[model samples]
Target: MIDLRSDTVTRPTEAMLESMREATFGDDSRDGDATVQKLEALAAERTGKETGAFMPSGTMANLVAMLAHANRGGEVLLEDGSHTLNAELGGIAGVAGLFYRGIHGKRGAMDPDALREAIRPVTRYHMGTALVWMENTHNRSGGAVLPLAHMQAVYGLAREKGVPVHLDGARIFNAAISLGCAASEISQYSDSVCFCVSKGLSAPVGSVLCGGAAFIERARAYRRMVGGNMRQAGPLAAAGIVALETMVDRLVEDHQTAKRLAEGLTRTDASLCDPKDVETNLVRVDVRKSGRRAAQWSADLKSKGVLVAPADLYALRFVTHRHISAPDVDAAVGAFAELWKKS
Candidate 1:
């Protein structure tokens, strides 16, 4: 199947599988796992953090980061389109007992003045803002990359108010590729960052949350509290290590392929998505103009051996990853073209 549903659908490479098989293992929850330890250390260094911890999913990573950063009754500042806000199933409020102030950003970037205004003053009646969260390569924005300067401005504004900043950087590498910079440079703007190795990197599992030593220690405890205390996680770590080492640079190819896909969609009269709007691996198609609901179109595409996902009632999303080649992009466009012609 040509699975454009999400980058999460990417499979592990043969080398990753081999490393997983040969990985040295040890009890993680009890004693420690050397491979997982190495993975955490490497992840921290890459993101320019003092330490790191492993999690089963990016949601848990973000949750733990928030749990560590904010008090139960405090608040978190969130971008309106953040995955943690709209997609994380309310773990911030439900699990962590924290409320969020949503600041709608322009192209997934919050205005600095808006951020300053949203921060509640210290008072008896109001919940004080404790953590500020940001998402880079925002999913809901069709994977738009947050510019480094934009992030720095937010960071500066947050610092003035003494609020800690956490980045839900699940697709940080994609943003890094787009910006032509190291992921660490993007990570430097926040106090904590969580990144997935499973998505575009094509690892089988795992995400890493990196931060200062104290923050990571608290996050590690939070992970254990949430049943993320692991055992013999070396196999997962092995693949993650390979993903970090071998798979980062090739994301340029995925970006190019996504552009190709967008161009193809623009050529087809039925599509409402502008090819110019596509910046990275994700392309959002507005299908309402085509007289079909986004979900219906997604299902129809899936039936025709090309998978996609709905972004909203009017829009569907296509994400390119290592598993999706340039040829696959053309095939997917062809499927859409055929379906549109019939309609």
Candidate 2:
């Protein structure tokens, strides 16, 4: 099947497999593994941060960031459709002991004026804003890339309120390629950032959280508290290192394929998707006009040898990665068109 469900389905490359075979197996939780340290340093250098700590997943990295940055009952301000609020299973409140205020946004960017109104100082009546959050290539917004100018404005406002910022940059490299800039250029606006190597990057497992040395040191303790410390994680780090070195540049190809798929779907039915909305490797299709739920569409397409995920009642999310090709995109589009005609 042409698996357009998510980039998380991507497998490791041969280079990553060979590196994992020869990787050092030192204990990371005790003395710190050499391979893991190397991977962390590389993650830090890429995101323009002083240091980084390896985590088992992006969810853990984000939870650790929240735990390290804020006290109990503090508030986190982020876009309403953010992955943290909608997808991370309420870890922000349940585990981190923080209250979250979802700021209204468009295409993953928070409204500057709305954000200005939301940030508050500690008072007996309200829990003050503790952290300002941002996400690049935001998942729920169909992989929308937040503009740098918008980020700067939000960061400036947060700084004025004496609040620190955290960026969920799981697809920062995808955002960088779409904007024609370095990942650091995007990450510079936030106090801390985390990115996953297991998604479009094609690493088997791992995410890295980067920030100031002291902040990362604190995050490491929180990482342990949240059960994120992997004792002998050198093999995973080895694959992540290879992913960082060799997999980033090719993400543009995935974006291109996604655009191709979107354009083709639009040609079949304009109500399905707008190609312009597809800025990266994800395509969010609106199937509300078809009088069929997205879950139904997903199952129909899967039966025709194409796989996709239902994002909501009337929306579907299609993701492209290294394994998908131009021909695969055309086939998926054809299958979708066939179903559209039947509907």
Candidate 3:
């Protein structure tokens, strides 16, 4: 089956699996696992951060960052469609006791002016804002790359206000590849950053959170509080190490395959949004004019061995990943064309 559902669906490569099997396990809570330490150091060096910590999932990494940055009752500024706001089960409010000030953004990229206006003043009788959160290659926004200049502007504004910025960079490597820039360029604009190795990188599990040593120390404590500390996490970290070392540069191939898919979809139906909007590994199709519900369309595609995700009642999404090659994309496109014709 051609699985265009999500990047997170990718399985680990044979090499990654072998690395995991050969990893030397040690106690993470006591002596600290060597593989985990090596992975953290490599991730920190790549992102140009002072320190890094490994978490089991992107959600935990994001939660750790949010908990470390904001105090109880403090507010955090975020895009309305951001993963931290919409996808993390409201952990910021439920666990951290922080309020969210959601500002709507175009294509999941917030305007600097909108972000500035979202910040609450200390005199506002509320807990006041403490942090600003940004997501790159935003999941809900068709994997849009948040422009570096815009991020710099927002970070500058937050720094002026003495508010820290935490970046939810789950697919940030995709953004960096798309922009032809180093990932560290984006890291420079954030006080803290979290990214997933399990996504496009095709690792079995793990995410990395990076920042200054003090902030990471606090985040580690929060991670433990949330019962996220694993005793022998080296096996997972070994896969993450391989992902960081080997899987990043190949993202350009995924982006190219996504463009091919987008082109095919647009040729099948021009009523959908322009294919130019598909800049990374995700393609969002507006199926409103097709006179078919998204769930029904998805089910139909699944029956034909071409899996995809329903974005809404009238929209759907396709995410190209490492497991999907150029030929697989062509086949999926053919499936989409046939389905559109039948519809």
Judged by lDDT, which candidate is best? 2
TM-score of 1: 0.97
Error of 3 at 283 (Å): 0.7
TM-score of each model, paired residue for residue: 0.97, 0.99, 0.97
Give a tens-digit lDDT track for model 1, residues 22-89: 99889887788999999999999999999899999999999999999999889898888888888889
Per-residue alpha-carbon lDDT of candidate 3 for residues 173-247, written as tens digits (9 for 90 to 100): 999999999889988999998899999999988999999999999999999999999889999999999998899
**CA lDDT of each candidate?**
0.90, 0.96, 0.90
Model 3, residue 337: C-alpha shift (Å): 1.9
* Residue 193, candidate 1: alpha-carbon lDDT: 96
**CA lDDT, candidate 3, residue 335:** 82
State the displacement of the C-alpha of residue 56, model 3, in Å, after optimal TM-score superposition: 0.4
Which 10 consecutive residues of model 2 have the lowest summed lDDT?
A: 269-278
The prediction achieving the highest TM-score against the true structure is 2
Candidate 2 lDDT, tens digit per residue, 165-217?
99999999999999999999999999999999999999989999999999999
After superposition, which runs of candidate 3 have C-alpha atoms over 4 Å from their true positions? Answer: none
RMSD of 3: 1.2
- Alpha-carbon lDDT of model 1: 0.90
